[model samples]
Target: MFISLNVKFDLFYSILAPNVIPDGFVDGRQVTEKLLEATQLDKNLYQCGNTKVFFKAGTLAHLEDLRDDKLNGIISLFQAEIRGYLMRKQYKKLQDQRVALTLMQRNIRKYLVLRNWPWWRLYTKVKPMLNIARQEEEMKKAAEELAKLKEEFEKLEKLKKELEEQNVTVLQQKNDLFLQLQTEQDSLADAEEKISKLVLQRGDMEQRIKELEERLADEEDQAANLNEVKKKMSSEIEELKKDVEDLESSLQKAEQEKQTKDNQIRTLQAEMAQQDETIGKLNKDKKNLEEQNKRTQEALQAEEDKVNHLNKLKAKLESTLDEVSLWTKWIFFNIFHSLL
Candidate 1:
């Protein structure tokens, strides 16, 4: 191929080589030179001239093959970019569709469950009574109120247990206080009769407490029923409140104990007229027990108030809970500490 491409050859020396040249500098000869350089072919196969090039016939075919391969690759790259963009756009739309369907399914399920409950039926019926034209998002208000009521009912159940235990403690405390009063007022017939009556009343209270404890298990089941918890819980709470009121009745023994102490004081004063020191000491003891009993009565009354205001007590149990907790612990405190 090299020996065949010399200017001495008729093809190279022909008028055709000068015909393929530049700008006239960029015409046939320049195009031919660039193509020849890209192929790194034997230079003898072609000759460039001032205005033209001369080449063997098959040389132009090599340039044609390179051009076709380059155009096909660029077109393929453009097609791949467009295909990727379309696939990503379609995938994003599909993901959004799936998410929307999931949310719709979730919310609809919640609404259906809430609507099917017995509480929901009762709420829908009685909504008018509360003037429940739902606003300020009143449904939200109703839901909050429902949660608050449930919390109160739970606290009441706990309080009922505490008060029952504390009731026994209070009764036992009263018994001890009166026993002291009995010792001091032993000579008085009136004091003796009253103390005997209180003892009988305490026996009746113990029997009543036993019956209430047996009833506790049954009521506990009713309180736990979620479907009827709202309406039935309120009715159940009212009955428990009555039981608490009966608990309050037991503390009346305190007032009777007060009378017994007063009588003892007077009898001590008259009998120990010369022994002024013993009289003063007995009087001092009476005053301390009175103060303690007064505070105890007030605390029980406050517990009753908390029972009534269980709804109002969102968080503030304050010292009342502390005192209530101590009620059981200090059950023996009065028996020993007060005597000492």
Candidate 2:
């Protein structure tokens, strides 16, 4: 078998070319020793025709040349070695891709499943609370508006009542003035008839005429006092007219205020209704967000369970690899001793 190995040694030598041969390999101990020594010098080396050669790490040129050999055994080993190296390289690439993919998958899964979990909870709980706060603010504003409207309405009502009361008072004063004017005119006519009767009596007696003259002077003084009273009444009538005009102006102002208050109440009622509708919509949206939060929670739980299961599988795989390594070492030791 060793001589047959030398038959196509040139092919192997080229494939397993050594960069530096070891100092003590001039006399070979065994095939395995020579192979081990050649590998130590250059791990890419392969054996053929009692020599070693190196091939590039990923090239198949040497293996292709060896395939032309008619002997199946020699060709088989060369093919096996090339296939093993390629398989190992391919496996390593797959492992790297798997590791990268696993990390990427884990990160993607985490973000997809867990990243929004807290955000969902915040949206569910905090959004509703914010909505409630906003609704409360709106309610407060509505209440303030209602209060302002009611206050203005009350003020306008009070002012209107006051104006009506003032108008009634002015009318009463005018009626009193008319009654006083009638009484004054009746007194003036009675005084005129009494003075004419006094004049006729004065001509009847000389002594009586002297007394009558003094009485006439007293009557003239009373007429002068009446004229002064009439002048004062005329000034009072003018002052009452001014008061009536002022009352009319106040009545107009009160009516305008009442109209403004009515408008304000209408506006407040409209705004309050709008706020109620907005609050209802916000409440509905809050409910929907809460349902979404529940679904997110369930999804996060499922992802956590999957990650835990994967961790267990990875631990089991590591344990199996350890066992395989120990078995391989035992087999290698046995084979080495048997060869010795």
Candidate 3:
């Protein structure tokens, strides 16, 4: 029965190693080492007889030549190694399958919970809160509208009161101004009546003054004429006095002329002697004129010499002017050449 168990173990190991074993079974450090060592051994080597002996061999010739005890021992050892490798691989595969199935179950449970979560939260928690928030918003809007209305009402009341006061003030000021205007009108009428009376009195005074001015002008003219008449009378009296003195002087001169006629007869004899003396003086003056004519000819010769000297000076001035003109022409020619 032990040998049969050993054969079954060998068959199981063969199937597990080639087909049934999972890759994760050899992932551990210790199991990987054993798997690698077993893979290196010759697959054809075996131990077949009772109390088998093992061999390390690769070719069929080497395996066939091995002693029966060595061959059987090698086969049994290989079978044991293969059994241990397959058991560990099966255990690791079962563990991984268990873990995969558990994870799948957990994911299924999470999917179910998430799928219902929103509906539960909305019905149980959020609906009532949203309704309360909407009510609060409406109440806030209504309160704001009420506040605005109240403020407008107060402002309107204040404006109405101010308008009433302004109307009363205007009416009072109008009444006072009307009374003052009436008083001013009465005073203006009295002043106008007084001005009219004064204007009449002024006209009468102006007429009297005009009449007095005319009378005064006439008296001044009469006085001026009287003064002129007095001046003329005084001048006539002076002329009459002068005429009397002339008449008296003429009467004295007539008496003196009668006495001078008597003296003229004596003077006529003295004049005949003086005429003879005058003829001798005339002959002496005629001889002096003939000497003066010779001296005048000598003075004329001296004046002619002065005239010739003045002519020579005028010729020298003309020569100097010609030289100045030539020099001016030369200077202008030189200046024009330098500029070009």
- In candidate 3 the C-alpha lDDT for residue 277 amounts to 41
Give the Cα error of residue 271 in candidate 1, in Å. Answer: 99
Under the 3 Å rule for N, CA and C atoms, how many clashes does model 1 have?
A: 16
- On TM-score, the stronger of 2 and 3 is 2
Which sections of candidate 1 miss by over 4 Å? 1-32, 114-340
By lDDT, is 1 or 3 better?
A: 1
TM-score of candidate 2 on Cα atoms, chains taken together: 0.30
* Per-residue lDDT of candidate 3, residues 206-260 (tens digit): 5654555565566567787665655555465455455545544554554455345
Candidate 1: residue 207 Cα off by (Å): 99
Ranking by lDDT: 1, 2, 3
Among all windows of 10 consecutive residues in model 2, the one with the lowest summed lDDT is 20-29
Which candidate's TM-score is highest?
2
Higher TM-score: candidate 1 or 3?
1
lDDT of 1 by residue, 1-340 (tens): 1322212322232223333333211222335565466556778777765423566778656645756666688789999999999999999999999999999999899879898797875565444333323332444554565556556555555555554555455445544543443455443444456556656765665666556555655666666555454455556656655665554464465456657677765654443343344434545555655555555555555555545454343223334445544764676787888889
Off by over 4 Å in 3: 1-136, 208-340
C-alpha lDDT of all candidate models, in order: 0.54, 0.51, 0.48
| Model 2 clashing residue pairs (backbone) | 9-48, 9-49, 15-53, 16-46, 16-52, 16-53, 16-54, 17-53, 17-54
lDDT of 3 at 327: 64
Candidate 3: residue 261 Cα off by (Å): 99
